[model samples]
Target: MTENWLNQIKELKQAVTHSGKFHADDVFSTALLRYINPDIHVERVNEVPEEFDGLAFDIGRGEFDHHQEEKVYRESKTPYAAFGLLWRVLGAELIGEEEAEKFDHRFVEPLDYNDNFGDDYVIARIISNFNPTWDSNENSTDAFWKAVDWAEMILRAEFEQIFSRIRAKEEVLEAAEKAEDQIMILERSMPWKKHVKDLDLLYVIFPSNRGGYCAQAVPMEDGYQELKMPFLKEWCGKSGEELQELSGIPTLNFVHSSGFLSAAGTLEDALEACKRSKELGTLNEGKQPVLLNVSHGISSEWSKEQIKAAHAYGEIIDFMLPKIEGDISQESVENFIDDTVAKILATKASVVYCDGETYLTYGIVRKLKKKRVTVLGACHNLNHEFVEFVELK
Candidate 1:
């Protein structure tokens, strides 16, 4: 038979949980129940009575608890805490399934991981701290209630953001459909990038909450620093009449110096700016590509398969050997790092496969990032010999 109690949770009057130290899993579970039925009474006890029939979780080794010898786990292999098990059953009933799934991934899974495995999160830590200290005079029951109240605020905030994103989707999609010359215009400001990033859009124009309309470049690929097409270099950092004069857009606010974002006083001006930018073409159209290798112990550091992986990102790998014969000094290390970065900018290989001493790699990566060079890192899978190149953060 179906669980009449679970189905009739809206009418639930009394709930119970184990008495003792509390955690986010149990705290959030209580907060969620309170969110559903504000008047429901809650009890924390060491043991539940046989005749007592009420919502029970994180205790009694009942439906919600996973402390038993055999346990239930998510398909992703994350063990379900009391909170997660509750969410899995009733989350869709509260919010639609899609949004519930998102909430579970964002909030539930992390807290569940903290409860099941040793993974830590701020929510878990804060709730755990709510438990009275061994020497504290504070009441445990009061502390548990305080923690539940905080979890409710967090849960409410997450739902608000999720709902806002959902609302933005339809508006973003409509604008994308009406896009002209690779430009999308939003009627009001909302998050638009995630919805249209994969679309054939070079620029997006939206009403800025700070006033005026904003025009922005689309990234070449998500997480890539490069833009599909950046705004004109000449218009960058120009504002007021200066920007208007350069672009012939009558009402201009300011065009950022980076050429990735700009604000115009009117929607017409924003569109005009995007149109002019498309005509100007990409900046540094002929900036060379280089593949420089400046690491000590090249042959030993890299396998033949790893060397082949490096070549996939860029063509030539000029293995520039280190120049110190005896003990190396800090100055020599600095020189090697500086020379490597400079050579990379100069050759057919700013796009790189970087491997070196930890400190040297750090310096090289920092400098290359500033110059807008793509940095590559290796990822090896279960098949040890196979190596793949991926963009490094």
Candidate 2:
């Protein structure tokens, strides 16, 4: 049995409701209605008047109430609270049918479960927290309205993220089509990692924000629990001059401890590392690895003059000092350097170059060296100094 609530909602000048204590269902229902038609007003009431004119909900003896002997249940047998009921009738009209159904499953289903079954779901708890406490001096109606504002913001942000993922999918598909047999080289970085699971690729090479290219081994499956072909264990946990000497690839920068990823100074060197990895895989089987000539340069930083000079050497990862207004404490500077190192590590940068101002601080250089990440600093006019050459226990 369907109510003509859709058409009835349109004629109502304001949403008439019972107030005092509000539940998630009532708050969400009011929010959704207001979002659909911003001009509609909300008038709280204690009793259902005999000659009620506007749309009545929650406490009123109207079609929106679920407290009566008759109840509403979705196809899945979950009881529909006021929010679910309203969503079922009018959700598709606001959003498309497919998205509305998806939203109901992802967002509305849990709320309905908590409202009907007395479950302590997070969303229900969040809405309940907005209520005025017993000792508080705030008005109940004001508190209820505050929760409505938060609910609207949550809904809008979630919808935006969902649509963004949909658009990213198209870009991933196009890249997959043109990808090499065992590797995919993306010109720029994006949220493409999630969309490449089913493709028959082993490695993904892309330009890192830290400068040079990064060669990341694609996991055998989702969650990256394991890789299709990991970098050779011989170079694991090694970086800087040592990594370059061991690999005999002058441009090699770092190899993670797990051997799942490695970095190179240039695209050519990154691809060479990939080739070496495949060779090791084949040598273990008494076979030869397939070789491919793939090289390209990408950089979000570096001026045209700088690129021309440094392109041959690959990407240069540098950290420069920020301008400070007044005297700075050593503790604060150390904390800042720690945070900067953390951000660079998150990108799995192989080597990081520091400006003379930052390098003058011996402790900061020591901290970067401890991470096993290659650190280069300008010491004097003649040449650049390598922190890797400094011995630290």
Candidate maximizing lDDT: 1
- TM-score of every candidate: 0.72, 0.56
For candidate 1, what's the RMSD?
A: 6.1
Error of 1 at 216 (Å): 1.0
Judge candidate 2 at residue 353 and give its lDDT: 45
Cα-based lDDT at residue 93, candidate 2: 66
The ten-residue window of minimal lDDT in model 2 covers 286-295
Q: Write the per-residue lDDT of candidate 2 for residues 1-393, one digit (tens) a residue.
A: 256556656656777777888878888888887766667888778887778666777766557777776888766667777788788888776565777887886688678777788788888899999988999999999998898888877776876776676666777678778876577777776677678878877777888789898888876444322467778888889999999999999888998886678888898888888878877863222122111111122223433233224212334444444544578887887787687667666765444544333333355557757665445432221112121211222
The lDDT of each candidate is: 0.77, 0.68
How many clashing pairs does model 1 include?
6
Per-residue lDDT of candidate 1, residues 308-370 (tens digit): 554433344656555456788898788887887887777746466665547678788888877
Q: Which stretches of candidate 1 lie over 4 Å from their true place?
A: 1-8, 92-103, 118-122, 233-242, 279-393
For candidate 1, the lDDT comes to 0.77
